[model samples]
Target: MEKQPSSRLGPLEKLRSFKMEKQKSFRLPGSTSFKEKKYKESPGKRGDMMLHLAARAGNLPHVQMLLAEAGEEGAKDLVSKQNLDGETALYIAAEKGHVEVVREILMVSDLQSASTKANSTFDAFHIAAKQGHLNVLKELLNLFPALAITTNSVNATALDTAATQGHVDIVNLLLETDASLARIARNNGKTTLHSAARMGHVEVVKALLNKDPSIGLRTDKKGQTALHMAVKGQNTGMVLELLRPDVSVINIGDNKGNRPLHVATRKANINMVRTLLSVEGIEVNAVNKAGETALAISEKSGSEEISAVLRVAGAVIEQQQPSPHPPNPAKHLKQTVSDIKHDVQSQLKHTRQTEMRVQKIKKRLEKLHIGGLNNAINSNTVVAVLIATVAFAAIFTVPGQFVEQPTPGYTLGQAFVAQNAAFIVFLLFDSLALFISLAVVVVQTSLIVVEQRAKKRMVFVMNKMMWLACLFISVSFISLTYVVVGKDDWWLAWCTMAIGAVIMLTTLGSMCYCIIMHRIEEKSLRNVRRSSTSQSRSTMSISMPSDSELLNSEYKKIYAL
Candidate 1:
């Protein structure tokens, strides 16, 4: 009597008819299972009430029963589906600390398949980690090993989330797996080490460093290391953790070459500064790229506590002044030529053996026409091409300032005067600075070449160079002022003088700062060398294996592992 199920209603009609027939013959939740409906409906449509229910009722039997009868296809639709906001059931389960539901949802292999993914589509591991659900995390990692590498939509892996949350145990577990701490970066170029140090998670920091001591010195985009972050975070425990022998705190700096000590000075933490100085070879007076030493930083930062620490550490606090210089052209030129010849000869001799070996290889390969040799030649050619390309791009992209701009101010008369003045000044100061820099470079090179021959104290040479830079920059500043004053505009003249004054001060300050820093560094290095010497002498009585044992014992132990 029923119009044969219309062909247009194909699959839908068939499903409905089947359900209706089954309802009469079977006691399914077809149309009359309010209780069952409440339980059987996927967690998405039910809101918080259902989430609570799922947490309470989503046991092995309950889920299995729902899966078996509800045609699971309907349930699969709810895997990642959201009820209100953009959160899926998996997210809800993970966030609510529902371990069983999280596991149940994760177990559905269908979720991993291409078609019906978890409604959240997020790796459940990240959610569990962020929520500090350690057990749930373990289960997820145990079941889905690939989840260790899987990142959420924001490109944060489970390990990253855990580190960010300061969940030490969770981070340790994630670290135990092959989830490389090095490979994980937040949206920033920051690593798990960065997060741990910033959060003052001392145990986590120690655990991370024990895994890879190199990470202790690894830098973020801002060029800050774990030590710098710890100082900035004002975590004394973390700072101590990072000051171990293995930490190598001096290895990194910010964009300005400001080290952890510099940051500590900025933070005005006397205790942190003391802790940092307690390291075996800390450089208290190390100058940054900006030429600001820790003491200078403290003074400039207006932090009295930091200044006191620096003073006690014997950091020099003085405004830099221009140094005196002598002008001698021919003698300096002769020395320079001699030094250049020596260096060139040394470089040539050192490269000679390698060059001869390469030539022999080339000759043999040419005679045989071997494929492997051809590949080597091709690789070398490719490398050469890349190098050439880079060189050309760099050359072409150089700033226009270097090439020259035709300033409207430079008339023929003015040009003539300026050129003559510049030439005269250059002859005086340029030659001197060049000679000094060249001399230092030669000495440093010669010392390296001759294997520390004569060992003329390096501090003396650095100090000499610093003085030369100051003198030369002072001369340059004076010349710049003269040139600027010669221009027509009175305001421009004053501006020029002001700029020269600033440049002169900055350059002189940097030079003196570098000199003082080199002296401090020399002293520190000497102290370390002396301590090592003394220790070696004290331990000299011990036999070979005993010395080895002592050295081995020096390594610090990490506890949070």
Candidate 2:
């Protein structure tokens, strides 16, 4: 009865009412509908579900159907929405390699506007190229060729992504589309050619250069050309490949002003150095920001191989002098003197020489720091013997829970005199050894204390000696266990004792060695500090003479040095 009134309405009246309702809906607040639109467009689980279904079904028809309704429709427009991670419909399509589906969507009139702001402006093309999907890339490029140079959020173009990932064919396709992409740089100023060269993708690199020859030696943000990354990676084969006849090796410098030679020198690779040096137009005298040449770094490292290589390349090894002037003269100097005196010059030269010496020692110290302690401990045969003795003592004398009573097996004559006497003698010797082992341990500890206090170079050696003592005690305990506890069940007792002895000895020896090495390091650091302090004090105490008293004050400064 209530619906009867509406059923009676004429068709013209119904059409007028429908028009009024549609107009009212359009009149609703922009903020309300816009917010709802944004939410629906957001890439969430729902968006992912639709995409999953579309991809699995390879349903270009459904995707096309959804795309046709985008912008005007609410939920269906979400197909173009960004996910939580900012992946868009196009990104998903390219990732899935759904070429037909991607083409259908791209063909839409609002294709460009449909792109989500959260996405890399380059979108699906970059993802496809990065993932090495050639067919998808061709489809996207066919639709929009300018996407070749379109950048990601990081300003990486599709060509850059392809080159970085070593996607050879994709790189080739992009390069062919826009030959200028070879020169177009990212925010970091790295060109696609730079990425391909660094990754050692020879075919891709050649193709890019063949497209545009000027990018052969372009540099990145740090001023590192493709050659620098190649050398640093120690990709010798790639390095060789990039060394085209026209490649300018010398002109390229990294952030540190280091050419390829500097990298080769630090790597201590003679062959790499030789290869770099052989390059045409390479500079022998080029210095890094530190004013250090390849030869200087090689000398500082004391690497004979690298030094020899540089020397062959006519590298000049410049000697650096220390600063004669005090770091904070007012704090140290009693009086001010004018002018650069002879004493000041001499002091400066001495400081410089000392600095050079310290640098050389530091290089050697690093090598020792890594493995010296372990190697020294293993080499000391006496330390090994001592550790074995201590381990034996622990295993034999440190009594365990007695599971059974000892059962003696011997003839009356042997048992009464020889065997029993031998047991007594063994006991006596074991006691003496235990006492001596304890004494050794005490002595070693005392030595460590002395070294820690004295801050001497010999402290390392002394610490090593202490470790040897601890090892001796540990081995003695292990040996005593095997010798004394095995009167019954000789085989089993001896086996356990042997294993225990080895473990105890090795552990104690290793610890001792580590402690000794650490002490040595401490002593070396202290010596360096002391030397620095003395040098500073000497520089400050002596004043440079004025035009009036040049000889008297200056002579004193010289004499002190």
- For all candidates in order, the CA lDDT equals 0.62, 0.63
Per-residue lDDT of model 1, residues 1-561, tens digit only: 355556557879789999988867877445655675675554544453343355445455555555455456755655544544445556666666777776776655343531222345454566678889988777767776667777665566777777767888987898888747446776667777888788877877777878777777667788887777888876788877776746566545788889888888778888888888767677777777777788888888788877876788778655353436675798899989999999988877766765676566555543443333334334433433433344334323322213244556564323334345643573456446555655554444344322222222343344445455545745654554554455465567466657767876786677677556656655675686577777878886311223222222211121000
lDDT of 1 at 295: 89
> What is the C-alpha local distance difference test score of candidate 1?
0.62
Residue 36 in candidate 1, Cα distance off native in Å: 8.1
Off by over 4 Å in 1: 1-53, 56-62, 111-122, 245-247, 318-561
RMSD of each: 30.4, 18.6
Model 2, span 238-336: residue lDDT tens: 676677636675457888988888988887887778777877778877888788989999999999888877787788887354658757867445344
TM-score of 2: 0.48
